[model samples]
Target chain A: MSLPPPAARPRRAPLALRVAAHEDLGGGLRWLTLAAPDVAAAAEPGQFAHVRCGGGLGPDGALGTRRAYSLADADPDRGTVSLLYRVWGRGSVWLSQRRPGEVLDVLAPLGTPFRLDPHRTPVFVAGGTGVAPFIFLARRARQKGLRPLAFVGARTAAELAGGEFLAAAGAEVAVATDDGTAGFAGTVVDLVVRALEETAAAGGLAGPSPALYACGPHAMMAALAAACAAHGWPLQVSLETPMACGIGICLSCTVPGPRGPGFYRRCCVEGPVFDAREVAWE
Target chain B: MSDLTTRLGPLTLRNPVLLASGTAGFGRELAEYLDLAGLGGIIVKGTSPSPWYGNPGPRTVETPSGLINSIGLENPGLRHFLEEDLPWLRTQGATVIVNVVGRTVEEYAAVAEGLAGADGVAALELNISCPNVKAGGIQFGHDPRLAAEVTRAVKAACGRPLFVKLSPNAPDVPAVAEAVLEAGADGLSLINTYLALAIDVARLRPVLPSVFGGLSGPAIKPLALRWVWEAHARFRVPIIGMGGIREWSDAAEFLLAGAQAVAVGTASFTEPRTAAFVVEGLRKWLDERGFATVGEVVGLAHRAIDGEEAVPLGQS
Candidate 1:
């Protein structure tokens, strides 16, 4: 995938953002509101920020820093960007210890965002923290006068994030939990398949069939991609891969492209967002 | 204040810390994390005569405290760099060293010739050792004659001080160093990433799309240090040592091994301000040890064994 010229999209540096608020969403998850006006102003649904942890003392404390998290919500006027993250490793553990009013190093407006065509009814599917970007997409759609439909899946009730926010925004949200502690008693992909089928049976996919957007585990996305392909809906996905630098320089985040298995694209630059069908999911 | 001024031949660095090329893309990618101008110097990503998309993806894999990559020297070509990136880089304050690569000797000379009189361009690093690309990369690095030829060719066309980046993958790193120095190389950068590979047992195939990648980080530090140590012992040319430098201690090891300066590569990935942090650490280490100028610390390990210096402090 050829990236946009550097002139078109100016790269942003990590902003020393103050933590406006912090909420503990248990099961090792966090909801952070960062005071990064620059990021809030430029952020889009799928693009993320690279957050560097361990802002302890001098430069040494900042070593082995940073992880990318999709923006869950952004308010340009309020100068805030929201993120929901699970404590997965040492980095997250360090991030978790951060208190309000503390400054964290954050690089924003990174990668391509999930595109929302106002005419197309947006169907967002997410698993776990994958629900992050949809908060922005949902709000953006509402601003454009579109009421979105969403499906969120988690292993259990504790793992689900942003369900309340989606509902508050007047979205038709369907929740699925593997343990049956939530809406649908099975996998999210199964719920998604049923939702599409029911919508189609009710009036032959009337008025712009839903455009599919998903972000989650690789397996979950692959399943969604196949489902979208079968139903003939345009699908976009945000991929999560290991990255050294969230910029184009490192070449660490690679994924196969539409060119076939042999050709690879830098995920950090080429995409964190890609057409679901274009990605060569092995 | 402990002086960090470093001299690599005619080129004088603000300090001895450098952002290794390819690691810091054109010096802008890491701008968000640290002040780019604060570091000693920046060896921007390798550029060729024209744009190169680089190798197929699956370009990197992590091992231990290191990273291996097959980025194939992907760059926007010399013209684009000179026209677009250079103006912004010059404003950043730190010295900028343009790293040039090519599929052929003429292309190398042409790139250098283009940057010959560019303002803010401090030096040029000849990356004849990139092992990711299918051709003209490690081939020139491993061959003494080819390495010297490329060095001589670029040095003639480029007016600025030229540093030949030596490949640890060479048949004899010292030989390559000596050849390049003889061919008018102003300095040297030792131990580009070693050519390496990895396999996914589950997939039962090579992990990287290129099948082989260059290994970097702490995993290759000792190995890179050996070459830097050897090359420094044999030549007067200042050597910039890099492989896996995560912290100040790693930078100290390279200095002790005889590198006049240390380039932070994979470490920058971990911390964009790693070089700056290293500069801070080096300063702290120096002042605490009763040393002043960082120049005073260069090759300190080579001078003494046990508790003495072959030449006492301030005597040399």
Candidate 2:
């Protein structure tokens, strides 16, 4: 399925906006809805927002590093953008404490957005808060009249996010959890692999090979990359790294190329999303 | 109207605010949010003779008021940069300071020589302070002899004014400063990132893969100011001060501390328009303070205290 592009807002400097809403998503997770028309108007699937906590990440809210988070959803008409993140460090913790109406500085809709040709099926594999871009992808796919299949996993059922959106998008939703408190009792990657095999065996789909879209721990993404390679599947992976600025200026999120290229690439620019083949999973 | 203009050796900048090397990443990255040509200069990422991939992952971590990073001077070789990046940089309309680093003195000279006649390049900034690499970087800055040798070699190859950036970790920073000045350094930029490390309490291992990394940001400003003050108090050379400069006051502090100009480094990562903001803010500050030129503030602090401000402390 093919859909029209989102409303275009010419790229400008990051804007400061007020938080319209905030919600806790199970343990250590947060959902922040920001009142940023510019960001929402320009957001594309798989692109992320560089979020700066109003207070620093240090004790007493000292100015710590500004961190990046993937956009979970963006409503241009509503003038809003949303992000889903897990509290891993001071930055996230500070973000979690933000209240509605509090101003937040953000650089948005950055990096190469994930590409899913309408001719191919998009199989989204996510772990924990990695569900961020997957949810956006699912919703966007639905808008295009295509239904993607998503494998959502977490430590337990309590930690899952956005599976309902996958179902609403008409996707075949598969859930897994480490503690077997969800649909499947294993890793989401295994569930995705089995599902792909079943679809292929049933000879039940039309057009190009199914494309795999995944965002999770490096280990999980690396595993998915290898699985996709072994089965000759097209895979696009979203990456996460400790970064200062989400823009390309900071070399903080640099990584070597997949095949030992001599120089480094800024993950914030060259990608927060990359073809699995371009990544040096090793 | 306040004039932000200041001179570094032969180059006259429109403002005293320079985008420190490595922070601007070739100038185009920050250009997305700013007018690149508006800055006094952009010290491009430190380049070597050949490409360097830098350290393995987990290269940076955030500490209180500072960011610790070990990027290992990852950059393309001189030839590739000249062929690809320099032309685009030329179009940015900013004074381009090509910062060169190497494991050997000849490598530095070769890279400097490569940019000598390059269109759009204004000068060369020799980075002898990177702590991640093994062979040379900080080693050259730590010894007066090695610092002098690198300066002389690059000077011999390039006719452009040479600015050797000094490391705060030098064994004798003032001595290193004097040696480089004596060896024909047209100007200097001080101080580079300080050697620091962090421990992952849970894992009981060093945070960065390199074991130790350069500590930058507001945390290192005091040390940088001290070094710049010390070097300026003793030498006649123009010094560009930088270390954790995040605001106009920080840049102004450096100027009053004896620096002719200031470079915004890690602060650029924190805010893309920091250098430009500092420039604008400095103009407001100087105008309100009734100063005529940025040069008037250079070495002003040295004139304030009695001649006894220099109780020399051992260099890091």
Candidate 3:
């Protein structure tokens, strides 16, 4: 049967309203705060908002596509949210150019969110822009009175958008930079490994492993996964793909996983998040 | 009532409208925006014998009125398809034309061999036109002999109909089309992306990592129609016309210009529902014109032209 004539779907409650946008946290990266009116009723960590960067296309009448960015901050009761992104190309550059008072089209509370382990200790691993989602996850962890560790990596200290926010959320935050312009001189994995060694030496009361939640470049995620595997730590990773339609329709966001014999999953629908063990990293 | 259905050789399409590979992916994403089942058929993204990593960062760039893509034919490979994507696609209820690209005649044969018995796979559209890869693409497409060899190999390996997708970059597209037809290709999809490029001013670098990418969208429509008309005139095999077809009017031009079917590409990047929209528009057009069938319009241009020595229309 032919699909019902194309109609706009408006079933979702607005989780956030665009409150402000400006040059912040350094070059090519912009911070936009959205006010989520409904989140106060019920907001969960690990959920994201899909924003339609209004100027996504060029001047010659191209369709402006939408992108799914991590919600950096959210207040369920206050009905506010935040997002941080780097202006990589046209779509992102268009998003950064938006001004305050202009409501960007947004689809919120998407993807399989970060699931907190009730018994296991939580560890947050993020790389640069990948750090966006962890801010909320860390905040939610603290709200539930859970202590989490956040290890962040960037090219330098200036690129770290919400380091203070993570610390305020009570995460034992560690920083890593490719250039020795920040806390750790190497990668976040190096900091993580060093932290593990120190914890091991102290005969830590926390178990030998931590439940790892990571989001970053495939290389960083894979490295973190391998590190967690070596130490026998369970890990979850938020993967990225070039998504055309943020809905399940465009299989363009397909990712190879180790689940079934021919395991493939859509990042838009199945998850922007998955258990690291189940994902076939590529 | 108009008969929107048409035939490309033995394969019967519900209408003249079809979705181009790569641009449409599977029909699922587009189905959300428009009714996919209402269209003629769906040609999936280029598949291969093995999963390909494609190219690195900077694969796609938006040019003025068009797009340059160097996606390098990134796909999950054949094994993943036979086991995963195909089964799911079959449930959608459209003619599933699997677009396959090969690095060698043998690999093309191997992939065609595998798909020969695969369920839900109606035909194989050999993508000999991809410009991103250094191996087994434009090389075969530009040269008539290699195009014939690859077509013959795939034809021998698969019992299903074969549609050789030709590149516009070649000087003599009609010659290449004829060779493929002689080699047993049942049909043809004319005009894959033309070789093109874009520059990044901010980084002072090439917009795409490959430096040169294949151009598609409205920019290449006229050229694609020329090739389709020329190839259709020279060869008996049915031609699937594409490139820069964004709307119903463009699709109508291809049909009146003698295309057996029309594939909507680049437009899908901007408007996911463009294919279904075109299909609906074509059906209404036929009904209003009081034509009984879409086939009546195919090669209709040949009848009207004062001269017919395989000349391209809309040219001085």
Q: Write the per-residue lDDT of candidate 1 for residues B96-115, one digit (tens) a residue.
A: 99998998888899999999
Per-residue lDDT of A48 in model 2: 90
Q: State the lDDT of candidate 2 residue by residue for A8-123, as single tens digits.
A: 21326767889999998667778889998888888898999877664564333556567788988888899998888888876777788889989887777788899877878888
Rank all candidate structures by their DockQ, best first, as comma-separated numbers.
2, 1, 3
Predicted candidate 3 versus true structure: per-residue lDDT over B106-125, tens digit per residue: 88888899899898887889
DockQ of each: 0.27, 0.42, 0.15
Best lDDT goes to which candidate?
Answer: 2
Worst 10 residues of 2 chain B by lDDT: B307-316
Listed in order, each prediction's TM-score against the native is 0.78, 0.94, 0.76
Calculate candidate 3's fnat: 0.09
Report lDDT (CA) for all predictions: 0.82, 0.83, 0.77
Tell me how far the alpha carbon of residue B147 in candidate 2 is from the true structure, in angstroms, after superposition.
Answer: 1.4
Model 2, span B1-316: residue lDDT tens:
8788898779788888898988888877787766767788888999998888888868888887788889888887888889988887766566888899999999998888888878888888888888889987988989999999999999999988889998888777888888988999998899888899999999999988899999989888899999888888788578889998888999999998989889998877767778888988899888887787888788888875857465222221
Docking class of 3: incorrect
Error of 3 at A76 (Å): 6.3
Evaluated on the second chain alone, the candidates' TM-scores are: 0.95, 0.95, 0.94
| Worst-scoring 10-residue span by lDDT in model 3 chain B | B307-316
- Name the candidate, 1 or 2, with the larger lDDT value: 2
